[model samples]
Target: MYLHSVAAYLPAAIIDNAHFTRLNGLADEWIIERTGIRERRKAAPGENSNTMAIAATDAVLAQAPAFAADSIDLIVVGTYTPHDTIFTAAHAVQRHLGINEIPTVSISSACSSLLNAVEIVEGYFAMNKARRALVVVSEHNTAYNNEEDTIAGHLWGDGAAALLISKDRMSPADLLIREVVTGGAAPVSKADEAVTLKPVERGIVMPFGRDVFQQACTYMARVTQTLLDKHHIPNQELTYLIPHQANLRISLNVAKQLGLAPERAVSNIERLGNTGCAGAAIALAEVWDTIKAGNKVIVTVFGGGYSYGAMLLERN
Candidate 1:
């Protein structure tokens, strides 16, 4: 399957590192040193994950004029933050897009949601179940975050991104996915509550920063390298390495271990922070026009559930 188009919509409100420093009584430089995030976007009141997803889906649909709404037989929304638990984000997107009732599903794999959605879409195409598919990801980090809590507040942002995939090649594809792989293993040692979000709670609990950092880097690198090795693609051939926008350090460390140049890794964490499921997709949309035809791009992701995956693609 090929990505016909991709688009992103970020909230207008900007929360810089200084805001977190002021609330938590930490130095501005300390936030930067730890997360490498200078600022992030927060959705205003009345703006939630579903609204952002609709906006992003509208933008993607507008871009792909050749693919009509009626042709979309599949809709997949990857998000942990939902406006309501009763209705899936995909259903709302389909309704707003004026498309008929189709096979719509919601994925809640935290950061790896988008990658997992792509994998599902690929399966639909391979099975000849969908001629065209719509994938949307909305992340409202501010909605569930506790600003008073120092750790999670500063590391997250709010945003949404959409991708239109098709087997018919309705328009010039942004990239043709060469291969996708996703898997994860439990921690060998006793696990701590590194991250948790309950339906009744306002936000998630994220302690054990050191453990999360170590595991994130290890699994992300492992999944990325496995995909590359399986396809016999050298690290040097990758035009850009887009890892989950969890932290700048993790992206840089993965690149360093793979012997990739610092410039080859695509990163927007310094500006947009970690946008959960929308991170990699947003990064790709920001650099879509700059990626020349035939350029190879690899997106590796690790989410809160200890799930991780990687996808290798080439601009068409």
Candidate 2:
């Protein structure tokens, strides 16, 4: 599969650290030192996951003027936070785009949902089931998080990203999807309860922060290394490392474990906080234009479900 174009949508409402300080009594320095997030975007009154996904998709389509919307045969949305569970963000996006008679699916694997969506596209391409696919990852984290909660509320943010992918390269600047690997770590101790969101009950909460952090640092780096080793690519050869925007510490730890410079890792958490599954895709969209031909990039993620994955891409 080849990545044709990508774009991201961040809500205009900015929630600074001071808001958390006033709500949860968490100081700005304390939040920054732990999560590296000074501010994050929150969806406005009318905005939701589907709307954000549509915005991102519109931006991506606008970027690729040559690519017709009618050519898209698959639409996949990755999101854990949905405005309407029954209607689903995927169907909403498909309806908004006016693309008909195609397979539309929604997937949720916590924050790792983005890569899982990409893997689904890979499967469709391999089976000759689809050619051009539109994958959108949108997260309305603030919709299901309590700002008053001191545990993990301050980390929540709202954002969305869209990627236009094709079974074959559509342009000279297209990025080839070299490999994608994803798996779950539910068998690990405390994996299932480390983080959770029960919209009907308590919203999003992190009961076992230390366990989540330890597993995220371990699995994210391990998965990235797995991909690199499989392709016989050295760590120094990697042009950029785009890890899930969960925390700055986790990203830096993963980069260090891989023997890569911290600067090599692309991060947006400092400004965007954690946008759930949309984090990696947003980072990819942010850095897409600057990536040169022959550059090797890795997008790795570890989510609350104890799911972990990595995708290797090369600009060609």
Candidate 3:
């Protein structure tokens, strides 16, 4: 699969560290030192995951005006925080785009949802089941998170991203999807209980921050290096690293493990907080235009469910 276009949507409402100070009594410096998140975006009144997904899709369409909505044969949305449980965000996006008779699906693997969605599109392309695909990742974390929770509540944010992918390269500037690999570590000790979000009970909670940090730091680097080794690409040859926007410390740790410079690792968590699965995609959209031809980029992700994945892309 080739990426033809990409776009992201961040809500206008900005939730700064001071808001958490007032709500949870956590100081600004404390939050920043621990999570590197000074501020985050929150969906405004009446804005939800579906609406944000549509906004991102519209942005993608706007970026690639030649890519018609009717050409999209597959629509996949990766979101854990959906507005409605029955009516998914994928269908909502398909409806908003006015494209019908296409296969639309939604899947969630916590923060790793974006890469999983891309892998799904890869499968369709491999089987010749789809020609053009639309992948949207949206998160409405604040809707299900408890602002009062002092543990992980402050880390939640709302955002969305859309990617226009084709079975073959559409243009000279299209990003070639070299490979995508995903795996689960739920079998690891205490993996299932490390982080959780229960809508009826409590919101997003991280009972074992140390465990999550250790596993995230380990697996993100492992999966990234796996892809590099598989392609026989050396660590120094990597042009950029886009890690999951869960924590700045985790991203730095992964970069160090891979012997890559910290500056080469793209990060938006400092300003956007952890926008769930949309974080990496949002970062990709922000830096898409600056990437040069022959550049090799890797996007590695580790999510709360202990799911991990990575994707290798090259500009050709």
TM-score of each: 0.96, 0.99, 0.99
Off by over 4 Å in 3: none
Kindly report which residue stretches of model 2 are placed more than 4 angstroms away from their true locations once superposed: none
Error of 1 at 88 (Å): 1.5
Worst 10 residues of 3 by lDDT: 197-206
- TM-score, predicted candidate 3 vs. hidden true structure: 0.99
Looking at model 2, residue 191 earns an lDDT score of 79
All models: lDDT?
A: 0.85, 0.94, 0.94
lDDT of 2 at 249: 95
Q: Ten-residue segment with the worst summed lDDT in candidate 1?
A: 184-193
lDDT of 1 by residue, 21-81 (tens): 6788867798888888899999999999899999999898887788677888999999998
Per-residue CA lDDT of model 3 for 1-316, tens digit only, reads: 7999999999999999999999879999999989999999999999999999999999999989778888999999999999988889999998998887888999999999999999999988888989999999999999988788898989989999999999988889999999999999999866888999888887788889989999999999999999999999999999999999999999999999999999999999998999999999999998999989989999999998799999999998
